[model samples]
Target chain A: MQRNSKLSEMAEVKLLGVLPSPYVYRVIWALKLKGIPYEFVKENLSNKSPLLLKCNPVHKKIPVLVHGEKSVCESMIIVEYINEVWPQNPLLPNDLHERAVTRFWSKFADDKGSSVLKIFRTREDEMEQVKKEILEMLQAIEDHGLGDKKFFGGDQIGIADIAFGSVIHWLTVMEEGILGAKLLEAHKFPRLYSWLKNFQQAPVIKENLPDFEEAVAFYKGLREASLGRAASK
Target chain B: MQRNSKLSEMAEVKLLGVLPSPYVYRVIWALKLKGIPYEFVKENLSNKSPLLLKCNPVHKKIPVLVHGEKSVCESMIIVEYINEVWPQNPLLPNDLHERAVTRFWSKFADDKGSSVLKIFRTREDEMEQVKKEILEMLQAIEDHGLGDKKFFGGDQIGIADIAFGSVIHWLTVMEEGILGAKLLEAHKFPRLYSWLKNFQQAPVIKENLPDFEEAVAFYKGLREASLGRAASK
Candidate 1:
């Protein structure tokens, strides 16, 4: 914890999170985009840490970014905080209306972008139902969210893209490995499918995203453990 | 629709919302406090207006604030948009960390504060479970969300207070009227109960909050209709 001293004028960022987490990855990409250097502490979610608990007492969830002496929790909030603190490569748009639209999609990302949780908990008999829900969510974003723009906000990658990166880019890894299904079937959602490629190919995003094979292996283990817990209970 | 023209540049704030909606009230209170004048177009929730659908195509719900031709959806997002567009009576905090903390509470208000939705839909068999969940949600806020401050941010009103207004103050109205249950029993949640009093008495809040008896009657009707629909289905 670097107290606000003259020497500590420079923001010292320390990110507390677990890997293969889209929420965690969102923060990672935001930091990398702004080119803010930080130390990343991978946590053991099962055991938890005192620092993690102390940083986020309410939820005690991860992706807590400690800047100077303060901790910013929640991934999108952290990203926004990072953007405000370092406004170099502006993650959000310039126009007030565009900024509001970016927020609308950002909230959508949290509300609907968190579809992976529902997908993970899908019942064996209700697989089709869950798939339908996921597809509808994807389709809505594909049709309205992306349009024919290169990114969600057109030309540049902004908040909405960062918001969906975890759900689309990272969770796609989970969908393929754990569920053995393709979430963004290119034919079904050409825009979203194309958007994912462009998002991954972005200079900062391409560099910051986690390793592909590692993510697949990690998600497979996570799904098995999650299912095993449900079965036991 | 006031396009972004100099002729209509007096912050043309038009709120599209339905009454007896705490979500709508959140935006109303924000606008009033900022002393921003605006027009209100009441909409029928069941039969939403084309303007409502067009503005919030994704959610298709209100309170949507159409500010200078651009529309902002999601109540808290609308409030934040208001804050950014009109920085008169600042709703959010100054410090970056405090802003993040304020956002965390706002998200908590959305994530946990909206537990009333689940409580309203609970079955007779799951009544106790739902009640316990609501209690736990309330207890977390009571224990942590408030201190010796006059409001959630401090002595002055902040975004968190506006965020929780829907859950604590307004939802309490619904809880007693619709559920025949008293959630904010003074003895059970002293902090929350006290906070609600201060929140309601704020100049902008007191004057702007919907008529009390009318809200009660409206909610009672809504709950009956909602439950009736659930039963028929």
Candidate 2:
């Protein structure tokens, strides 16, 4: 009886999410890195499941990790929670200063990285402004964040790397696949360009990334819908 | 020689900030709670200091904590760094799940709680909209955040309390001191009202709160200047 109970407890980890979402992908990569086995429950965003609503009552958003009776919300918070629960393949550094620096970059990614997606959803008239904003963000990362290090922390892809993986990956889809723009010029942001290459090629990240064609189609639809709604308005 | 070296190393903590700034106070309260001693370096917002610019080149913002040769930016991140370094007061819970929950609230406070400040700085035309946003934020806290607990972590004041400390305090300043309004009526937010009373009465925070009249005058002048510029435009 005790053994059965223990098994049930061990198997209770579940993730509530929709695929092709950068926020959800952050949690997925963190869990994969930790090698903690879990179930993935797909959520229909248009009609949110009762479980998702119950799990994340405040935000009512995806990437909610349900562990046993408790549910953790927010992508970066879930990533940190996973790192805390499973110590293997550590996402943050051991040194105090290095950990602080890692967190600073993580916070930066959470704050500014999402703005890049505006280009995917905004009109062509606003594309230049959004592109300029994304370029400045990439330049900051190039100049101050990822100097010569293969990843933000060092050789290993850690929290900061996962935080940015979704941004750069989706930016590629939006800029190259849909918009056919060249905002992330290698010459302008050589370090960022290299960092994205290394990040995408990282083992867990490479395998788990959304299919390129699928992601392009998904965001292209979203852009059309957004522009269509705006035109009518 | 070893004793002298240790003492000097211990005394190397320093804080860069401006007075009455909630972000800066969050770090101050955290450090005070941990009983960590540090020097406070005031920065002129009009003329940014070299040390402030040097310490936080990315944001060029205040509430930068300089420890030995390392500097940590962002208020809540600095607070977390302080908690990690000094585990005496225990800003975060020991349980992995509880810590995750605490972090969730901390992130929420960082993300949404700051919107309350918009009421203080916004023009009259936008006042109602900002007020509505703040009321919704407070309602979320009332409904989901604080129940009957003395604090977010129960009994002890933790990271989330410090995160919202500046927002609530400044809201009180803006509403009561300047606007002569009563947004945070006790009946509307019974738990939050009790929490604020308990929070303000807490040891480290009570002693460190900025003088009420001074904060009022400072923010009022800034608001007038903001409105003046908007009118001219």
Q: Model 2: DockQ against the native?
A: 0.63
lDDT of 1 by residue, B65-90 (tens): 88766778889888887888779889
- Model 2 clash number: 0
Candidate RMSDs in Å, in order, are: 2.3, 2.9
Candidate 2, CAPRI quality class derived from DockQ: medium
Q: What TM-score, over all chains together, does every model reach?
A: 0.94, 0.95
- Model 1 spans with C-alpha error above 4 angstroms: A1-9, B1-11
Clashing residue pairs found in predicted model 1: none
TM-score of 2: 0.95
Among all windows of 10 consecutive residues in model 1 chain B, the one with the lowest summed lDDT is B1-10
lDDT (C-alpha, whole model) for all candidates:
0.82, 0.87
Model 1: what is its DockQ?
A: 0.64
Can you write out model 1's per-residue Cα lDDT over A72-158, one digit (the tens) per residue? 889999988888888798988877777877888888888876667666655567677777777888888977787788988789888
For model 2 chain A, where is the 10-residue window of minimal lDDT?
Answer: A1-10
Model 2 misplaced regions, further than 4 Å: A1-11, B1-11
